[model samples]
Target chain A: MDNNIIRFTYNVDGTDFTSAGQASVMLKKNLRQLGISPDTIRRASIAMYEGEINMVIHADGGVAEIEVSEECITIMLKDSGPGIKDINQAMQEGFSTAPDDVRSLGFGAGMGLPNMKRYSDHMEIESELGVGTTITMKINI
Target chain B: MKITTVKELLEAKVVWGEELIGKHVYSACGSDMMSDVLAYVKDQSVLLTGLVNSQVIRTAEMMDMVCIVFVRSKVPNQEMIELAKESGIVLLATDKRLYDACGILYSNGLCGNGVRRG
Candidate 1:
């Protein structure tokens, strides 16, 4: 029995901007029910939420996998869309290629990657020009 | 400050969560950008924004905020109200635009991360 770990998976719908953060909200509820520390839950959810939004804005939607453990929580966001051309620049604050429409929604200030980096204890981005992008972030519980 | 105080100060309409108005909130962040709210915010228990969408409520939920104030006469639709209801977050709408609403709260001592990060 894997007493140390629990996992959850979600399919993010890309078409609707309004539905973008639903996965993160669900994850927050799951964390609360698991009795995770509030700080840890906040950090994990913040990181995951930013990734989920980025997936919608850039990749048209994706899949998020969440794993909770005694030590830490890990979230992986994978998208098969026009991959990030420059991970370095994308990680920079205030640099974004998200369409203006996304900006109107109060996102696309180029803070997604930076926010994820700031909240997560560890962050990784794997992106290819036209293939896809996968971001993995971990926050210690 | 109690959530009811926020309502009085902003002269805001109670869109949802009337039952939560009596709850107390220590700090607040005002931002239209949801990610900014998520990033620059820490320990703030209230969210003030002009954005009307489901993510607004979700952002509040992720940050563990107790209340959300929509500025500039912006009101969330039915779906957003349902989301807030599920999260037990108090919702208010003010004809007071973002700057005025946030400023009034700020002068009244309801604040953010102490560094004005948001």
Candidate 2:
């Protein structure tokens, strides 16, 4: 990691399903401009995208922070929604807390966390029942 | 297949990225479920869906897709169109239903990337 790395932040709004993936889009452009490989950009963007959607749907919106360095791209998502009761169950495919409305809009299939984990080199979830959840994912460039 | 060919074949209207008409795409997938599209990891560049939302454009953008065809007479709203333009994704709308639209493209050489399975 270099001291001169670029960092970006986004304030995700939860009220609009139509605006959920904005952070991922911006991050993709930033990575591309940084001369990261397309494969690396895709991995990081998709992981962050899923996390962004989760923040909007499950949490009442959140903040997304991206830190770019020589070694890896790290995305941190913090949300003040009801924390997951069981992280294990939430990680399962098809286990979603999103309502039927979200499914009709083309999401909430319960693959959010799984897809994030699949695309990133590492993922960590820290949550408290009533407090909130913070997810940190890193993809090595 | 060229995106222009897709537009002509489906009698579609372009909502954005007119300059991408000549771009080539080897594979495509049709689904309203963004998760399903994310599950399938392949070298796909076209997305056909009945779902009209900003997430659709975002999904295509993340997958590095060059074009998105909205089937079953679905039309994207202003926000979605703006997003697609900004992302440089070609957006097309067709009156053809999802199955028929996909069938036409498939029969004409656009192959599905095949969804992921556990």
Best-fitting candidate, scored by DockQ: 2
Cα lDDT of model 1 by residue, A50-105, tens digit = 99999998899999998888888999999999998888888888999989988888
At residue A27, what lDDT does model 1 achieve? Answer: 92
lDDT of 1 by residue, B1-118 (tens): 8999999999998999998899998899888988778776567988999998788888889888899999999889999899899989999999998889989998999977623222
Worst 10 residues of 1 chain A by lDDT: A1-10
**Tens-digit lDDT string for candidate 2 (A41-114):** 98899899899999989888999989998888999999999999999999999999899999998999999999
**DockQ metric, candidate 1:** 0.65
Q: In candidate 1, which residue ranges exceed 4 Å CA deviation?
A: A1-3, B114-118
Q: Look at candidate 1 and give me any clashing residue pairs.
A: none
The TM-scores of all predictions, comma-separated, are 0.95, 0.93
Best by TM-score: 1
Tens-place lDDT per residue, model 2, B29-101, is: 9889998898776778999999987888899989888899999888899988888888788999999999999
**Superposition error at A100 for model 2 (Å):** 1.4
Report the poorest 10 consecutive residues by lDDT, candidate 1 chain B: B109-118
- C-alpha lDDT of candidate 2 relative to the true structure: 0.90
Q: How far is candidate 1 from the true structure (C-alpha RMSD, Å)?
A: 1.9
